[model samples]
Target chain A: MYSNDGFRELERHECLRLLAKVPVGRIVHTRQALPAVLPVNFSLDHDGAVLLRTSAASELVRAIDGSVVAFEADEVDALTHSGWSVVVTGSATVVTDPAEHERLTRTGPSSWVPSPQEVFVRVEPELVTGRELVGGRSLYGVDLTGAT
Target chain B: MYSNDGFRELERHECLRLLAKVPVGRIVHTRQALPAVLPVNFSLDHDGAVLLRTSAASELVRAIDGSVVAFEADEVDALTHSGWSVVVTGSATVVTDPAEHERLTRTGPSSWVPSPQEVFVRVEPELVTGRELVGGRSLYGVDLTGAT
Candidate 1:
């Protein structure tokens, strides 16, 4: 699907694939009844859930636990003005089960901040949407001639 | 001010300064009661409001008009693991006044999409907050030795 602005809409599978290619993303959630965004390093689970590791006592943990949030990741080329962006919207829940926590600790994304009390917050990809700006050409460099 | 996780807190002026350095940022807003994020090219007004150019008929214009939203911009170095991120929470309003629209059309950010009906959206910086991850050193490459 193509938007009126010429951006191509990506499929769910394509969105998830593009998301896994980037290590960092911005998390959007409500803070004090207003929206707030923070950038963090993240990873994708096999089931496509977003996994974030942060200090257990962090403000992010307090704000996003059990709340509907949005996770967005993108890669852009300034020279070509071409890029793709993916957003996943769902509930964010801090992992609390001992076994699950242990598994995530061993396999989840490494924290930028070295903290012993880091915990994993999982965001299910309940609504996945993405768009690609191709700059009048196809991904393979072929001119679309307004055919995209 | 510093957080328990070692990330340096940025003051309001510093946050605005960093925000002005980036050309692209994520806009976070509520869509159908769920948080949604989209990357947009923006410029800061003289009063620190974020100015965005988009099609008047775009979904973004519909979703964020007269609503509180978050605008976040950042620059990160993956190799050095250092970066600064700023988030501005404010009300987004579509510029509807003819004089203001005419002025913004002459002075505002250029549209990425070539559309004749593009309009400017202004986001007031009601609340600005930012954080800098310094990777155990000062921004000038000097060791802080835990003194920052």
Candidate 2:
């Protein structure tokens, strides 16, 4: 659903169908020169990669110290404003596999309450775009799987 | 405005007046161990420190690379349920003095439509905390400098 020169293009199964209904997102970059945004709790791996975990000293990891990133995820409904978003520009490495770190330590840990240190992050998405506002000002787009 | 463990103890102008009133936040950390969260656009520096910016190989610089970090910012308001939050665990350097980085550059270049490769992040809170939620239950806290 992209055709206006603004190019919406967001495929890859609609970016896994709007990133499987948002668990929270916002991971913009640039840390010492100014723009740094963070809000995590993401999981879209099964190959769709976008897993994240925190602590072990976090400025969201000194503003992306592995470079090359632009991860974004969205879901809106400010009372029916309608929404959908997925933007994942690539190259954010740092997941030295040891059987994928024991399958991310058997996947069962995410806390923001008192303490939950010991870091982890993996977002390997070359490029993916999306947008679907519909009914708050309409702006459509789809099939942007890095041009497939 | 706190009582639920009082945000684990907060101070630094009550964490910069709950970070001026959180428009939105999330900047958890950890890049090598995996956990990471990002979604930021912040304010609260007049020596209260917590600026923003990133780039130069991101991962928040591999989780605040030279270490001693843990910065957090929060906001909530499920509608009239009000909201307020602030967390700055302190010490996450990398500013490379350029007249103090052009005196903490800010004022323009973001309405949240960025993607030119982004860069900039500067958080130095030392230890700030906050809590506030009126109506959606109840939780109040203060102490960025006001103390409560």
Candidate 3:
């Protein structure tokens, strides 16, 4: 369904599919009772959970573990003014199991920053929603304008 | 200053400069007591406040007014593995003054999605922090891997 503002709602499967195509995303979590966002390189697990690798002692690990957070990924074409954005809201937890950690270390996303030790954080896809901005359709009888 | 992870901290003026170069950004806020993120076309005001124009009745408008929110923008190069990200955390307030609203209508960011009526949401840059990933340095003697 399309919203009154001209964005079409994307299905769950479509959302997950689009999410896996991107290599980087932003993670949103609360810091000191206020919202905070950080860009991170991420991958999608077999069950569509967002997997992130970061320094084990990083502040992100402390702020997001055992808390509800939002992850967003998108691809936009400035010329065509077309793109899709997917947001996954779910609980995040640090991967602590030895065997699971070993497996993830071998198969999960690699960190952009070089680190001596890294840990994986998993965000389950509990709530997924997305919107697509289609090109050339003027809804609400208002002219569509490009970002300024 | 460079962090242990190889990211260089950007100064406040540099953060605002980088923020103005981008046409789009993601806003992080709390929705129903859970963190949520949405991509929006935005612009910078004279004082570097993040300015967003959206439908007056949208969920984002209701979720962030008078609340602290985070706004993030970035530019990345996959081949060079270099990028800079700036995040602005501040209180958001809907512009209600008629004179200010009229001024913004002429000078503020134009919405990507067509809307009959729009309102401006301003985020004061209370805490601005940024990081730059410099290219081709084996910091800490570890190989930097590209996003996978």
Candidate 4:
């Protein structure tokens, strides 16, 4: 468990809270050393899982065919506003058990937009941490390190 | 060639411009299909190729060794409320020639503190595109689809 040494942990939780507000997130994965990032709509399942849906041809299905993956969600506020982000770096294996997958599938509606004939990606979050923007001060950033 | 759909073409140049302005860029690579993003500093050479130094000990050096990597650079503004982003998607191969590697090492100081030394990443712009935000109007997007 590598800790993000960039910012103090006080605002870590805020990052997750902000993530839940935004529906779009970047899913990062690798194929033969090349990093591929795709956008997906996600929701926090509260039962220690993050649920997401995607199409069969979408990149999500291609990458999650039984492999370790990292799911990231973030939001940034630029105005007299504040923002935070939470990234869940964990093993994203496809839900294989029909019952478990069905449970997650039933917890919420699928976010698949292009088609309803796509698979879903559920992240079993191993480590969850976040960062927040406080008081709407001139926004600053900590070096995005140890964030996964 | 897969065109970067969301990346506006004119903003592509702007994204490069910002890369020169800021030494660091967040590089996301996949390890066993998981997304691993790290903070790194890089420079643009005469041909707009991205040059960053690291060694075999560096995570980036290992990831980009022989893969199709996606590199992203973004600028978020809080002043006039505008920002731009650029993404370079291509294959990265190590510059093994002594002259080529040395010339890259001499370009400028690195963008990272407590640097990851000795290796280099050359991102040839196979696809470049960008987008900008302006005023209260719609998003300003340009597609430099066929720019070399």
Candidate 5:
């Protein structure tokens, strides 16, 4: 839906599609009553669940083992002054099933850290929303009247 | 301080230094009871306070006003598999003084959104921590034995 200003509010399917284009995003989880954000590499499962790998000793694994968390990703073009950001808020559950864990261990998202990513956490989306900057000056066809 | 793995825990000053290098970061704040993360453009003051401008009607502006939040920024070389991420946890306060607000309004971080960024939020650092992936096989003289 086109929201007020030049921002286009995207639907759930389009949000997931945009997320699939970005490999890295930040996971936000509450710790000690304060929100913490950490960057992670992720992949989407067949059901659109977000798959991630983290070390057993990592703080993120500890905070989001079985909690509601938010994941966000975006792409911005500085030259064109346009970009899109997607947010998926869902329940994060650690993968404990042996067979499932092993499968995820074999085909999980790649980690930038060299540490052994033994913990597999899956975020099942409860809500997904996205917005793209539109109506900006660009080579792409965007109606600039919506520019905020 | 060094951690159990090849990740080097950076000092507070070093964390601030890394944050200065990046113009964009994600702000993690609580909306209702769940944590949310939003990408933002920010600038650091000499005292290390993060300054940002957002539209008056933006959700981030509403959620972060007079609240505690976290800001994170990172850089990773995909091919080299080396990168550093820094997180700054702070209390966000809207700039109220007209003179100060106007000064910040004039000199605050630039926004990619074409909207009128009238609200200025300043995050004063409370906790700063960073980690750098080290010891990877690279021509950049990384200490590889420390690679996790």
Candidate 6:
């Protein structure tokens, strides 16, 4: 059901399920104190950690390892004007364990970009939130008196 | 010619032109000091400012006015494993001038989500950067020894 705001909050489980289905997402990290958004291809592990493959030489891999980052994915139909977005935030750490790294390298989600993606980083989500808009409608009916 | 990275840097004018063609993009803003990303329907004006329509009652509308934000859009072919992403960063300000507001409301990009989107915010891009991956390839040829 759509609320007055025309957005419905999705449950955490539902958000993860949606995240698993999508192959690409944008990763947000602060660069020089300004927020930078980079579209990345990622996969969800059974434990819900978001996995990414990047070149060890890439700025993203160097700048964000062991640092906090936000990953987001969404599916919106341009015609229906309806879609859902899921955001996951957590510290991203490199997969250093040899056995685990090998396992992931062999079977984890693959990267779409052609590069020497030797670095495998995992973000263990500390927070997950999602919202869905069911349709396009006139916002005129919603109260905006408190708008800033 | 493709570089060793297999990625090509896009010029600012080209990036803006591409951004103008997309009806949707993700906006990245800092909330409570943490980076947050939200997808928004947007249109680029002649001067290159990113325009958005949002309900006055929404947190994004209230929190981002006069704040710096990053907006990004891209197209990636799953089969070809190629895509380009453009990100624009600038200060977002709420339109306060009545005449300009009216003009924008009458002709600006329309939102797909039905809600009272009375607030019109614009981000005059201070910087724009983009990159394109030509195709999927093996990462083995790229040198990774210098990778961070």
TM-score of chain B of each: 0.86, 0.31, 0.86, 0.74, 0.82, 0.85
**lDDT of candidate 3 over B13-82, digit per residue (tens):** 9899989887877887777787777777788988889998877876677778999888888876655667
TM-score of each: 0.87, 0.27, 0.87, 0.55, 0.83, 0.88
Write model 1 residue lDDT over B11-100, tens digit each, in one string. 889988988877778788776777777777888888889999877776678878999988888886755778887888889999999999
Please give the lDDT score at residue A106 for candidate 4: 77
Off by over 4 Å in 5: A110-117, A135-148, B1-4, B111-117, B135-148
The alpha-carbon deviation from the true structure for residue A91 of candidate 5, after best TM-score superposition, in angstroms, is 1.2
Q: Where does model 3 exceed 4 Å of error? A: A1-4, A136-148, B136-148
Q: What is candidate 2's DockQ?
A: 0.02
> Which predicted model would earn the best DockQ?
6
What's model 5's TM-score?
0.83
Query: Which candidate number has the best TM-score?
Result: 6
**Least accurate 10 contiguous residues by lDDT in model 4 chain B:** B137-146
Go through the candidates in order and give each one's DockQ. Answer: 0.29, 0.02, 0.32, 0.17, 0.29, 0.37
What lDDT does each candidate get?
A: 0.75, 0.51, 0.75, 0.54, 0.70, 0.74
Total clashes, candidate 1?
0
After superposition, the stretches of candidate 4 with alpha carbons farther than 4 Å from their true spots are: A1-6, A10-13, A76-83, A96-106, A109-114, A132-148, B1-25, B30-34, B38-46, B50-69, B73-86, B89-148
- Of the pair 4 and 6, which is ahead by DockQ? 6
Better of 1 and 5 by TM-score: 1
Evaluated at residue A45, the lDDT of candidate 5 is: 78
Task: Name the lDDT value of residue A64 in candidate 3.
Answer: 83
Candidate 1 lDDT at B43 equals: 88
> Fraction of native Cα contacts kept in each candidate?
0.28, 0.00, 0.31, 0.22, 0.29, 0.35
TM-score of 2: 0.27
For all candidates, what are the clash counts? Answer: 0, 82, 0, 12, 5, 5
